[model samples]
Target: MTAKPTANTRTIGSHFTRAGKYAVLSFQAALTIFPIIWVLSNSFRTTDQILTSIRLVPEQFALDNYLNVWRMTSIPRALVNSLTIDIVSILLLLAVVLPLSFVIARFRFRAATVIYLFFSLAVLVPMVTVLPMTFKLFSELGLLGHKYAIAFIYVAEQLPLSVFLMVMFMRTIPSELDEAAIMDGCSILDLFRHVIIPLSRNGIVTIVILSFVAIWNDYLTALVVLSRQADKTLSVVLGYARNEYAVDYGMMSAAIIFAIAPMILIYILVKNRLIKGMAMGAVKG
Candidate 1:
């Protein structure tokens, strides 16, 4: 028989395995974090310094880039527009999806499977597939220059994944609680508001973050759908700003930072719940 490992040998092996995991995780964290640190540093440095220096940290820092971007670019206007679109898109998404997801999860219906499968397919359809169609449709409908119209597009794009996750997460909530609420003389809408929405908070937050990021970063929809220079979203404005600033690395970097700031802030706010929602296997079939 092969020798059974002694206590000392097993202890060392366990420690070695643990150390390996730590090392790998630390390296992965560095890879993820280094670029953010470098971008932040460069955002504070001049173009010449950025081009010449291979350093992650800047020798000197300045806010001139931010000031120039704020003054020159329509970032402030675009920021407001994007914020408005995101808010509208998210609210609409929640209103439609949460109730639909509750219906799909709580009550068995003939079309539920078909509808869920339809959304699953939608999740797989790339945004580019409908770009031409959307462009033509928006143009035909005289919606080309409309800013809020983008909110509808964002909602449609986000609906599939949001519905999928919310349905799955809602399924994880005990049906007994739902039954209890219904038996307590609660109406269906009241049951949904007090039972489903409260229990599905994690999934709600998760989908909000995902939807916001996708909508905020989407350049093609903004480019194709919203034709007005005055009404473009922040992503499209960033493109114009990049072109205008062409080799001005500092301003470009600052604009990029502005693009990502909202995502970072939202992440910080909901990170714990997001992690718990994702990692706890909350979205189960």
Candidate 2:
């Protein structure tokens, strides 16, 4: 007969397993962070240094590349445009999805299931599939090159998934709370505002963060929609930073850092909430 493992043997096995997990995670983190460090190192070096040396560490740091990038790119305007779009779109998404999800989760209407299923399926449709039609529709509406108006597309793109996640999260709330609130003379709007919305805070934050990241990082839609130079987003301007014949590596690196700064700052601010919200919301939903 085979012998059962002793406590000492099990403890040794667990230690090895834990050490292996850490080793793998540490290696992955290095791989992910190395490219960002390499780009930053390049941003501080001169064009000559970048071409002549492949070293990840620059001999010394300088501000010339960043100063030049500021002059060459529409940093101030594009930054404002990107921030406005992301903020507006996220607000619109939350405002619409919150009430809508609450209704679908709380009520037993005839078409609730059908509406939920429709939104769930809509989440599967890729934005690329409708690009041509979307372009034509916007053109016909005379909204091309309009900065604030373009946020409508971001709202639309994220709507279905937002509804789906919200509904899932809202469903997890106890229906008993709704009934109690109604018994206490709460109206539909009041029940939603005071009861359901407060309970689904984590889920709502998750949706906002996800929507913000998705809209901010999108280059394709912005490139096609914002045709005017004045209305172009940061990603679009970054794409055009290189000259046709000659590309400046150091300046391009600085431009990239500039473009990614907002996202990095956002992550730093909300990382704890993002972790908690994603864990509590998506997992519960």
What pairs collide in candidate 1?
none
lDDT of 2 at 100: 86
Alpha-carbon runs more than 4 Å astray in model 1: 1-28, 272-285
In model 1, the worst 10-residue window by lDDT is 276-285
lDDT of 2 at 263: 86
Which 10-residue window of candidate 2 scores lowest in summed lDDT? 276-285
Candidate 2 ranges beyond 4 A from true positions: 1-27, 244-246, 272-285
What TM-score does prediction 1 earn? Answer: 0.83
| Per-residue C-alpha lDDT of model 2 across residues 1-285, encoded as one tens digit per residue | 234567778899999999999999999999999999899899999889998987678888898888887776686678888888888888877878888899999998999999887766645677788777888999999988577777778887887768877887899998999899999999999999999999999788788987888788988889888878888888877777666213788888888898898889989999986666556545533
lDDT of 1 at 130: 89
Q: Write model 1 residue lDDT over 96-116, tens digit each, in one string.
A: 889889999999789999988
